[model samples]
Target: MARQCDLTGKARQANHKVSHANNKTRVFKQPNLKTKKVFDPESGQTIRLKLATSTIKTLDKLGLSKFLRKYYK
Candidate 1:
């Protein structure tokens, strides 16, 4: 699977790393992702998902059903 959040589609970002001497290096900033088993109240089941930390936080707040309705639609 790709390195991405299944729900929010968050992925690595291209950036640069700078040094004190003004040197720069190409870098990829990866999202904070985790494999989680979230309970879906509507389905009465636990769904496994690869999600970003922010998405997980929002899931905790809005819940799976509401979150999917809000974002996944």
Candidate 2:
């Protein structure tokens, strides 16, 4: 649709959505928890998530600083 001015020979066109390929759409599937984690999109790195939060806290408190140094960093 377009709007026209009554006093002058001028018109304004309405904005409309442009036609384009639906490249942003994605198909999702449920996770398979049995498999180990493989990727991290933010860092583009492969990682494993086998440790629980409780175990991590224990390690931090028990002075296993040398053992968990890699993961902590």
lDDT per residue (tens digit) for residues 1-73 in model 1: 9999998889999999999998999999999999999998777899899999999999999988899899977
C-alpha lDDT score of every prediction, in listed order: 0.93, 0.40
Q: What digit string (tens of lDDT, one per residue) describes model 2 on residues 1-73?
A: 2233221223433444444863454433322222134344457786654433444444446534443464456
Overall local distance difference test of candidate 1 = 0.93
Give TM per candidate.
0.87, 0.21
Cα deviation at 15, candidate 2, in Å, is 55
- Which residue pairs show backbone clashes in model 1? none
TM-score of 2: 0.21
Model 2: worst 10 consecutive residues (lDDT sum): 1-10
